[model samples]
Every structure is written in C-alpha cells, then in structure tokens.
Target: MPRKGMRSLFFSPKVSTSTDSSTSSSISYFPSPSRFGFSPSKPSFSESVMNRTLEMAEPIIMKWNPETTTFAKVTSLFYDNRKEAIVFIKWVKNLQKAMQLFITGNSSSEKLVRAQNLMQIAMKRLQKEFYQILSMNRAHLDPESVSTRSSSTSFLSSISDYGEEDDDEDTRIVNESITEVEDASSIAMADLKLIADCMISCGYAKECLKIYTIIRKSIVDEGIYKLGVEKFSASQVHKMDWNALELRINHWLNAVRTAVKTLFNGERILSDHVFASSDSIRESCFTVITKEGAIILFGFPENVAKNSKKSPEKVFRILDMYTGISNHWPEIDSIFSFDSTTNIKSQALTSLVRLGEYVRTALNAFESEIQKDSSKLHVAGAEIHILTTDVMNYLSILSDYSNILSDILADSPPPANNSVTESYFGFTDSDDSPAPPITRKIAWLILVLLCKLDAKARYYKDVSFSYLFLANNLQYVVEKVRTSNLKYLLGDEWLSKHDSKVQQFATNYERLGWSHVTNTLPEDPTAVRTPEQVKEIFKKFNSSFDQAYRKQSVCVVLDSKLRDAIKVRLARKIFRGYQKFYNAHGVAMQRDRNSAAVVRFAPEDVGHRLSDLFFGTVDSGSGSHSSFDPSSSHSRRP
Candidate 1:
C-alpha cells in the first residue's frame, strides 16, 4: 500500500490489500506510464501499478540524503567563479532550500547532525569565497592600482604590432574586464550586507558581527593608509594588531584636529564648492568608521548603575580627549567663508562662546560627580581646580590668535551729548575710546574659577587663612588681567567691580588679620593717664606686633605692587596713631623715672618697627628709623 500523497506522483490506482492473506502477501510490479510504455495486451493490473509506483519512488528515495550534496557543489562553483555573484547567490538560495527540506524531512539524529555539519561547511566556504571576491574587487577599484594598470596597458598597446584584429580583441577584453571590475566594486557593500544577513539567518550571529566588524575596519584602514596617497590604494592597507590599529586611529584623529586648527586659523583658503564637497566626504567617511565603534561600545547589555557610575579618572580622560579637539573648534569655525557674507571674527567669537558653554557643562558634570563622592572631596576639587586653570590658560592662548577680545575691550565709550561732555570735560568732545567675543567667555571662565576656588577654600579648617587665600588669589587674578590686553576686554566697569571686591577682602583682613594689633592701641590717644598705662601700652604693642608679624610673614602676596601698597598702608595707620599716643603721654612718663616709665621705643623707633611688622623682622633694640620714612613715595592707598 502506498503512503498518503505518495500515489499522486505516478499514474496508478489505489491498491487496497485487506482481509485476504493471499492478496496481502502478494507483491506486484509495473512500468511507470511517465517513464516506460505499458503493454496494452494482457498486462496484469497489479503488476503494472506496482511497477509504476516503484519507478516513481526511486528518484524520491535517491533525493532523501541528509548530507545535501547540492550545497557542496554550489560551494565549489562559488569558489571557482566568484565573479558570477548573481549565479552564486542563486545557488546559495537553492542550498538554503535544500537545507530546510533536509532538516524537516529527516527523523534520525545522525542524519540531522550530518545536515548541520554540511551547512556549516557550506557557510564557511561561502564566507571564504565572498572575502576573496571582495578583496579582488577592492584592489581593482583602488585608484593607485587602476592608474598603474591603465598606464601599463597603454604602454603595451602602444608597443604592440599593428594587427587590427588582435588589437581589437585585446581592447574588447580590457573593456569587459573594466566593466566587471566596476560592477564588482559597486555591488561590494550590498553583497557584504547580504552575506551578513545570510549568516544571521543560518543562526551564525557571532559570524555576522565579525563580518560587520571587518567591513568597518576596512573603511578605517583605507582612510588611514590612503590619507596622503593622492591616489587611494587598498593594496597599501595591511592587517594591523589592536595596538597598532589604535595608534593609527589616534594619528588620524590628530590629523583631523590639525586640519581643523588650520581651517580655524584661516591659514587655508578654499572655494565654497570645494570646501563643502571635501567636508561632506570627510564627514561621511568618519561617520562610517566611527559607527561601528559606537555600536560595539553601546551594544552590550549592562547594569544601569554600573554603566552610569563611570570612574572619575575615566570621565576625565574622556573629557580631555574631547577638550583637546574642542579647543580648536572655535578657530576652525571662525574660518572666513569664501562668499564674504560671514565675518570671520564674529564667527570666531560665536565659536568661542559656544565652546565656553560646552566647558561650563563639563565643569558642572565634574562638580556633580565630585559632590557624589564626599570622601574624595579634596582630591576631586584639586583636580577640578587644575582643569579649570588649564581651561583659562588655553583661552589665554586662543586670545592671542584672534584679537577680537582686544578689539571689543578697546571699544570707545559711546559719545556723550554735547551738553553732558561740555559739563563733564569742559569740552564738547573727548578722545575716542577704543572698544571685545571671548571677552565674555574669559569673564565667565574667571567667574567659574573663582567659584571653584571658593569651594576649595572651604576645605581649609582655618577660616581666616581661607579668606587670606581667596584674597591673594583674587588679587593675583585682577592684577594679571589688568596688566594684559585682557584689561581692555574686561572693561573699566569690571575692573572697578573687582577692585572693590579686593577692598572688601582687605577690610575682612583688617577685621580678621589686624584684630590682635588694633586691640593694643588706645582709641583716644590724646588723653594721658599714669606712666604705668603708657609703659603697658607700648609693651603690649611690641608683643602683639611681634606675634602678628610672625604669622603674616609666611602669607603669600603674589603681586609686588599689591604687597608694597599693603605694607605702606599698615605702616601709616599704625605708626601715625602710635606717634600721637607717645606725644601725648611722653612728658608725663618722663616725670616718673620708674622702670615702667622707660620708653622702649621712641616715636621714630616705632615708625621703623612698623616697617618690619609684615615681614616678621621687628627688632626691639635696633634703631634703624631712617629706612622707615612713612611719607616715602608708594602706591596710592586702595
């Protein structure tokens, strides 16, 4: 009896063998009507049906092998003539169909395993063959090799015998080769994608990823190797180890940075059309190369907390990398357009402002991270402070290139009305003031640095020292800015504001710094008391002065002019008051010749002593009052 649906393959009537032992035991054979002629004369019905069924089943049985020999044959064909990618692809499809049928039709584990092994071999072979074809096509499309091939061909043709038929045949072959090369190169990407898809379908996902990686790497390799070749050459690309490849990538990035820097510096002039075209090409190429890296980095599954908690060191490294490139972005973007519609200086200013915003964001992130880690406050704060300082330094360097800030700083104050000017200057007009983009940026940077410094100052246990530190740093910043071209950009208003702040600091210092010394002085020096009071006052003054001087001597005052001004102000305030007290009480103290009435310091001696107070050199005995002239030329009091 035939299995269900088996009878349809042959021209035969259904044979029912049942109940009768004789009929069930008997077997019959017959010629298949589609295969051989059936005898019309007295042929047995059972025999003819049996023979037809047998003939039909023979081919089906032969096709049931689990190994699927067709795949192997297709693989061989692909290897032999990989250029016929269309034909190879068709065969691959057939092999896939055979694989599906074999998996579904077979019941034995051994046969299924055999089918699996065969498919693996086929896929492996296909990959190998695909790679070879791709490589060959890439070589042919390579600009350098193309030129070499063309030149060689031309030379050969020029020297060849003038046999028209042979020459024509050779030309036809060359044309055909050229066409094939073009076709291959054009289809390479599509073919790669197809191959990856096929691998994925075959449950070779790992292989698919590798294929994508290879494609990305090839692009990067080509870009690096062909950078200055003029004629692009795939032949020059060699397989690099991971370290070497990383080095190359860094080299390329640095080159890009250099190019961008030059563009910003306005060193290179390019037409709008050419610049746009080249820029597009560069962007596209970089996108292709970086895409795979981005995918690989982000594709993996990771814990949210773990992924979010990047180490400060790593974050800083990443920031440094970005900052290194971003530092040049302003100049790059500042490049003047060939069309002359955009002002280069204005563009530079915009770029600088944008860069400043980015840096601000980074700083905010850094501070936020530090806030989360309280134990490392000092360490992190110091690092952040350094980073901010570096940003300021970098901005200073940038300012040198574009005097946009300087120009803005030098902006003339708006002209006053004739009445106002005549009233103020006793004239209708005054000299034009000079007139600043990064001016704002630098100002912002300074503000940020101050904030950071203030934050760091909180780490110190001593509030007075912290105040002193702030005062010293703030004074230094103001002095540096004032002395540089930055003074113009910062403007008179800014200078005034900072100067006022410095005065405030000095006031704070007086309250905090001079408390001990001021306590020793009598508020009303004109009123005289006993000689005991006079002696006590001078003794207390000398002791307090020595103590205060020792403490303040090591204190930093970076600006020399600021230091001199501070010293002179201290001298006049202390000495003038001390001299008043002595003149009022000295006569009375002379009347009492007690040991307490013996003055340790004359008025001139006191003046001399005040000079040495700040520097911790108060000598109670040495009478060197000549060098301590309080009325000597000095910086005007703040």
Candidate 2:
C-alpha cells in the first residue's frame, strides 16, 4: 500500500495553462517541488514566512469574494444559480490552493489555524447559498412572483375579516422559507460530499480526514441520528466484538437511508438505471481475508513445551492474521494487487491482523527466554510500537492502495445493476440520495492522527520488537562481528576465539536442536520431500525425541539395581562447591538445594519439590528473567 508515485512529486510544473472547459477557472496542479525549489532536505514548509504570506493572501481572498454578487453579476448569469454555485466553489478552491502554495515552507500552526478558519467560512457561506437555492427553488422564481405568492398566502381570505394578516403571513413565509432552506441543504449534501470525496481523491488525505472529522462532529453534535454517530465511530474503529461490529455496520446503512429521505427530501424519485453499488473487488477482498485468517488459525505452530514456549498465546492470533492477509491480500496477484483500494473499511480490517502477525514473529527468541521468568512482565510502549509499526506498514500500504484505487475508480465504468449486488459490507456515503454541502481542507490532518495513534499504541506495550531492539550499543558491536562489518572493531586477534565460540555454540545448540529437526525424517529414503513434508518432519523429530528421552528415563527408574547404584550428582557438587567456598572464605555457605539439586534414584524419592519453575530446579541462564515452573527445570542439578 505504498504510493505508486504516478504523479510528479511537485505540482507546479504540471500545471496546465489550458483551462478545463467544465471548471470555472484553470486551476492546474503543481507537478513536483523541483519547480518550487523544494526537495527532501529542503521541505516545502515555512512557518513564519508562510504565515505572513497567508496573512497577505487573506485580504486578496476577501477582495475576490463574490458572495454579495448576484447571478446577474456572474459571467454566464443566465445559467442556473446551482450551476453558478459550482463556479463559485471552484473559485474558492482556487483561493485555497493559492493560500496553500503561499503558505508552503512559510506556515506556522497559527497560520494553518487561520487558513482553516478562512476555508471554514467559505464552506459555511456555500452551505448557506445552497440552502437558499434549494429553498422555494429561488433560482427559478423571480422576486416579483415570490412577493405576490407571499402576499396571497398571507392575505388568507377566510382568516382576518377585520384587517390584513400581512405581517403574520410574511413572518410565516419567511420562517417556512428558512425551514425549507435548512432541509434542502441536507439533500444537496451530495455536492459537498463530492467535494470531500474529491479532496480525498486528489491526494489531500489530511484535509480529507479533517473534513470527515467536521462532518462527524456536526452530525453527532446535532444528534440527528444515533446511527450516524456509530457509523463515523465504526468506520475508524480499531477493535470491537462481532455484536458491536455488526451494530456499527447496521448503523451506517440505516443512517445513509434515513439521511437520504429526511435530511434531503426531494420531489425527484430515485432512478432504477443508476448504478450506485459496491464492487466485487471489495467484497472479494473481504472473502480473501476471511480465508487467510482461517488458514493461519488452522495450521500455525503450537506450543508443546511450556519449558520452551516462545511467544504468548495472543501472538498466534496475530500470526493467523498475517497468514490471512498473506493468502488473501497477497502482495502480487494475477488480476490485481492489494496495492490499490485501501479505504477505511480495508484499513480497519487489515491493520488489526497485520499487527497481530508481525508481533508473533518479530521477537521469536525472547518469548522462549521469558518462560523461565514468568512471574513478572513489565511492558513498555516501545514493544507495542514495534508490533504496531510492523502492522502499520500494511495499513500505510493500504492507504496508498486506496489512492491507487481512487485513481482506478476515476477511470472505471459506473456500477452495473444486478440483483446479486444487493449489499455493501463496508461503507457508503449515501446509497440513494441527493447531494449535500461543500468544504475544503489540506493534507496534514491524517499525518498528525497517524503520529498520535502510533505514539499511543507503542506507549502501552513497551516490549522489545526483537532482540535487536533491546541491544542498545552492544547490537551494533554484535552485528559488526556477525556480518564481518567491523573487522577493525572486533580486531583480527579475537577472530579465532570469536569464530571458535560461535562455532562451538552452534554445534552444541545444534545437537540439542537436532532431536527437534531430525527425529521424523523419513526412514524410507525414497520418500519425496516437499516444504510441508520437511516441516512436518521437523515437528515430528521434536515430538519423537521427547518421547525417546522419556522412555529412557522410565527404563532407568524401573530398574531398581541400576537406580540404587547411581550416585547423586547434586549432593557431590553442592558439597564440593559449598565446602570449597566455605573453607576458603571462613564462612558457612548455605547451598540452595531444591529436590532436583539432590539426585533421586527413585521417581518417588524426589517429586514435585520446585513446582513453580518450568525446569523445576533447573535454572535457565537468564536467571531472574525466566518464569519458574517445577517439571521443566531439570537442568539445574542431579
């Protein structure tokens, strides 16, 4: 879900002098920052100078304001005032772009705030104009007829036999007109919705987020619909149960329906020919994800030995998610790549699983090491951040995908009518309704939200993303040694010893781990080996090796003569180390002894002495870092 980088990085050079016949003015976009002398090192962001520029531009904007001008003042005044609304909106948008261009590299937060205020004022005015037009179809009705209709309605022949009801009637007409205006404004929301959609479609992600925020706040605060509050909340949601999830889905559908009828009641009937439908591309995506999740859940490696357990159970769930996406939302597919079409629906669904999977694999060794030190777990935000960041990559990619999808959609044919295409699972602004109001915004809003959300998620789960995350200064030192990058740092003198130690460590661990890898190797040498076949062989080896060791231990225990003959290894070592230390230091040393420390020839001789440790009395080299379990810690002693 990365940006395809199809458009030029800077927008100025790409700006065409040729005017778009459809638009009010020729508003060509900047192609790349090179045209403006901006680049990575020199970003197009200026706080002080930007503010001054914006301040300077505000008066120019005010000067350009055409709010007071009537339809007659418009160049093509004979056109519907609604059509004029489009032109005026375009002009306002041009002013906004001009302000953005001026503010680049020169804007401060305060200046940005001012810019928002100006944009909001423009939106509010457009909202007002749209409202007025919709009310009583004032665009078509002249002042004289409007006046006559108003007077006749006011003079009710049956009402006042004594005097004129002019004042009351006029007041009623005004109130009715205002109410009509207000109601029509909601129906016309599509025009505004289109603006928001265009803002997002045009790469103004932050502004899109901000405008969506405003829409949510306006509607939610107004308490127009319970479902709307839920839809807005649901669309951006991170986690929720199935019931709540379904509730959110239902709420959105209902809100779209209700808003279409109540907020924008219109004389026009919805056309059957209109192809407003969610595409197979989206629903198929959900299906793929679902199968991916199922596959991961079905086949993930399980923790057979708590003694050697690596990550927590929760991580498996996460891994399953990664698997799900890997299978469903593969990086490259024949028909399409998930590189496109990352909308709110995709982000919410994809991120959760992506995060879960990355966390499962990111810190493989640490989870196993922690089994011996289970008593305490102090989490830090950095750990969660690592997991979040891993998953966030996908979401980020998904976002990029959305942008691509938008571009694709721009080129796509309209939706086709089909009885099968009855439902949309994710989100829709309005299934069948008139348009609404207009607003504009810039791109920083989404970035800020992403930064904050990332900050919060990381703060809570401060686990190391990997061993590398915890290495501090030592990691670079180790990496240099490993990759032969720091021959100078480690020095040539230690190379022999370093190689020897690493080799020796590898050999011994290999021996210990071989039982895990080779036990299930096909005894029939002719057997073919697929990847899955090899994997199963390894798991079988681990399982069989475990069984073999248990059988050997059982046989020794059952033979009484050998069992009695066996000398206690722990008793000798403890006494030797204890006596040596005590005699040398001239102090009595209390050698810590659990049942495992004292060898037992009989199974019943020493049973369940240290119940808390994984290795029983066996101490993992990590010492305090491990969780204590009684049965597993056999490494500690006799």
- Go through the candidates in order and give each one's C-alpha lDDT: 0.45, 0.31
Provide the TM-score for each candidate, comma-separated. Answer: 0.38, 0.17
Q: Give the candidate number with the greatest lDDT.
A: 1
- Clashes counted in candidate 2 amount to 65
For candidate 1, the 10 contiguous residues with the lowest summed lDDT are: 297-306
Tell me the lDDT of model 1 at 638: 20
lDDT by residue for model 1 over 1-638, one digit each (tens)?
23333234234554645867777545334333544565445433333333443343223222322245564434433334333433333333333443454454354545445445545664665565456544555544333333223323322222121211233454454345445545443234334434544554566645544543365356434443444212212222233333543344344445445434432121122111111223433233234333332222111111111122232223332233334334654544443333331343343344334333333444455455434432323221112234334444544454453343333333323434534433322222334531123454456556656766777768866455566666656776676676666676566666777776766765676567667776787889756466667778878877876676555544544445555666666766666666777788766676666743455556676555444433223344562222222444433222
Off by over 4 Å in 2: 1-124, 127-190, 193-213, 216-315, 324-638
Error of 2 at 491 (Å): 48
Give per-candidate clash totals: 17, 65
**True-structure RMSD, every candidate:** 21.5, 32.0
